[model samples]
Target: MSADDSSATARDSLDGGAATLTTRRLRYLGAALATLVALLHLLDPNHGLLELFALLYANPRVLVFDPRPAAFVVSATALLVGVSLSRNAPNRRPYYVAGIVVALTYVVGYLAWHLTGHGGFLPGREPLLHGVAPVANVVRHLTSDPWAAASMASELGLIATLVALLRRE
Candidate 1:
């Protein structure tokens, strides 16, 4: 092949490779952001659950009265993002696995807490009568006490996973 032709082919190949690498990096970044958000939720320290509840209230469409569904959505999204980004990255499987595990655990725990009536992570009393908004009333009664323990566990797990991802070679 002529030198010019060979050079052009090489440039095109280089450009394609660079584009692929950039896409992969962006995906990884998205995964990292999702993981960070989860970690923030786990680490938040609020004694009354008021702050947490307010935060949830802010996004009523997502959190509503029942947080399990919302949490599930967040966790599921995180898992998908983590998995997609880590597909070809080194030591990424473990991070992705950890993230998925944590997300699932959070959802399961939320559901269990609601079923048991042991009180939720947030604090408030369930309205006497179930009105049009059942989830809101349920969420109101969720005392922060339950969250203290659960949050501690979640915080530890998320921190460990975050560290692993950061240190992955």
Candidate 2:
């Protein structure tokens, strides 16, 4: 081939490699986000350390715990599945489906619960602040409460990952 053709081929190959690298990086990021979501719930500051320990290890309410715990578990499982899928494991469709379903469910359920006046375990946890000043709520949580911010971010990341996995490149 001519030098021009060779250069074009090399460039195309580099572009392809970059795309693959980007894809892999995104997958790893998605998993990391998922892990963060899990840790946030596990280390939620609202509950005491003993309460967290009891809830995870010695409490009867563990099975029927609140949405936060459920959300974390689902996110963690999705992270695991995402990692496994990255390894080129066969039968990846189910894993993808599970991740999408769980992430979507958590997002919708968490939002609905908060919006419907049943948000927090404590009393009167309605989203009045959000209703009055949405930006304020976002800014407060993003700045003061990193766990909440990370939870929201991880949901978005998982959603993006789900869409990317579903779509053909």
- Top-scoring candidate (TM-score): 2
- Candidate 2 is scored at a TM of 0.58
Write model 2 residue lDDT over 1-169, tens digit each, in one string: 5564465457658787775566566656666665665555556665424444567787646535443554455555555656566556544445556666766776666565544434544444444555535445545545776666676777778778856754412
Tens-digit lDDT track of model 1 for 103-145: 5575456445544453334455253323424455446544435
Worst 10 residues of 1 by lDDT: 125-134
* C-alpha lDDT values of all predictions: 0.51, 0.58
Root-mean-square deviation per candidate = 14.1, 7.5
After superposing candidate 2 on the true structure, give the runs of residues whose Cα lies further than 4 Å from its correct spot: 1-18, 47-52, 56-67, 74-78, 81-88, 119-144
Q: How far does residue 117 in candidate 2 sit from its true spot (Å)?
A: 0.7
What's the true lDDT of residue 80 in model 1? 53
Off by over 4 Å in 1: 1-26, 47-89, 118-169
